[model samples]
Target: MSINYLVLVAYLVVTFLVCGIPFGKIIARARGVDIQKVGSGNIGTTNVAREIGKGAAALTLLLDAGKGALATGLALWFFPAFITGGVSVAPHGDAAGLEGLVTLAAICGHIFSPFLHFHGGKGIAVGVGTLLGFAWPVGLMELAIFLVIAVASKRVSAGSVTVAAILGPVFALIYGPNLGLDLLLELAGLVVVWAHRSNIKKLINGQEKEFSFHKRGDKPEPDDDTIGESK
Candidate 1:
């Protein structure tokens, strides 16, 4: 095989391995807890914050986001030579089609982690990181939107879903149309939304739980009737 193809394969392997490391599990182990058995049975930052300490949750978010950023950065370094000459460039932009593919792969690895029995986090943190890889403006705007909605609704799921729902259009408007990036973001957003399907049902039934920053031990468990209502 050609060197470019070899590099591409190597990139995919490394990105998947790095992104699928399951930082939540590592943090939970350090705290003597199994994150997968905790709130929402998710390994995402929100669940970590609910079950473990906020410090652990913050660390997990940063690590997960870092995975995406690192993967995309590597792709940008190695994949530029692979971009076809005929590919359309966004205004004043270089070839980033491969970056989109790398971002998608990183997000997929986080969401469907091979190390976690193919079940993983909701991908919000990594998605933000991937956008950051694309451009600081895109990442900052999405992060701002997420913060606003999350604070207003008091639900991380709500903020996550809302930002994901609008990511494609917003990216298109801000960065100009790059069909590869647009399609990748659309797929990534849908996957994120699907990951929160249970949360959506809870919201529709007026039963979704608001986020709490308190440590898990600080709060008593909700009764069975209220269980499974929080993420």
Candidate 2:
């Protein structure tokens, strides 16, 4: 398969820009709140939920996830993959690798967004959305693992890292022997785990705060343990 370098680069750049949008920060700004100065100072869903209201957080999540899904869907549409009766997928060599790279670009856009001067969110929602757009079964798998761990431990980062690290095997199982594409997708997951490094450390040290919703009245929860913690 001959590669279209020009089109590939253009697609990646577009995906990066689109997925890089900091909806969390934008929503906060609309509500007269600076998400960057609140909670963990991250322009992600967690920070929005913790600092702003649930409505704003939901909007941010929806937008962030939408961009990622759109990017991934475009990739699969452009670099069509080989599916066996809509059950199993086989690699299309160059096209498969390109699809993985495109999906990776989507997550990278959120983690190191050019719009935010290379600073951005932890990439959880976008990563899931990207995978969901790529292979919904795999996406659901990751989402299930994330929800289980998150709910069990009350720490979102734990769920994020677990899903990110496990994608290698997940791809290996579902994508067959497409080592190159599998590895490429694993790179996408690695970028997500990298974004959650601080949270990883906090978790290891038992200092990570549990995911909690802020009051709608804009008042802090009296028992909010995250009030003093910077995370």
Candidate 3:
């Protein structure tokens, strides 16, 4: 009925479509198979990288990040900014407690995309983008932590889990208590860690695979396609 209500509803719908439908279609058509059927049975970019080539996986990653950014942007636009005193500020709407509703909607859309029969990615990048949209400081902190872990472990899951753990209290502190953002982060962190449970087991067993981005001793030059195939 009210402008805020209409905008809030539109925001949720748009985020779901952006994070769920488009991402599912991209994974399906880009790789000629639904990502849900691939490694780990999850549609996240990490699984995409393992199943499809790096190129397609990169595309999915970018798209996922874009959806989070788009959702937060829409939420901000809908909430509007008003000048209070000498500074411009976001005026709380009736849905003030729904601060990160757009972020959650986007993440949920990615985690259980309708297009993928309610199965999708583990929500690492989507969460990163959501935090980035909410607060750049916390987002950068999480990003730095992820990069450090990824480099050390060479495991995307390791980095993702670590980042999620770091985000919970970080966002809570930044946004203050009594805000809805902490609840969303807490739930999202749980989901992300739960999704990586298998990876954690593998890590404990020391059987976890590492990403290979190096030249092997037997690898041939780029021009030697014939030899490369045999190698």
User: Which segments of model 1 are wrong by more than 4 Å?
Assistant: 81-95, 216-231
How many residue pairs clash (N, CA or C atoms closer than 3 angstroms) in each of the candidate models, in the order given? 0, 0, 1
Per-residue C-alpha lDDT of model 1 across residues 57-103, encoded as one tens digit per residue: 89999999988888876566556566566543332255455666676
Q: Compared with the true structure, what per-residue lDDT tens digits does model 2 show for residues 1-231?
A: 335566678889999998888888888899888777667778888778887878888998888888888887777666444332343222434446766777789888888878878888888898888778877888898889999999999988899899998886886776565777788888888888877777887899999999988887774323333322222
Q: Order the candidates by TM-score, highest first — what do you get? A: 1, 2, 3
What tens digits encode model 3's per-residue C-alpha lDDT throughout 1-231?
766567667878778777775463475466466554444555567655665656766777787887787677556654554212332212223333454667678777877677656666778888788767656677788888898999998988789888877666876566555355566667777776775667777788896668642132322112211111100
How well does candidate 3 match the true structure in TM-score terms? 0.75
The TM-scores of all predictions, comma-separated, are: 0.87, 0.87, 0.75
Higher-TM-score candidate among 1 and 2? Answer: 1
Cα lDDT over the full model 2: 0.78
- lDDT score of model 3? 0.64
Q: Which candidate is the best by TM-score?
A: 1
| Candidate 2 off by > 4 Å | 1-3, 80-94, 219-231
lDDT of each: 0.77, 0.78, 0.64
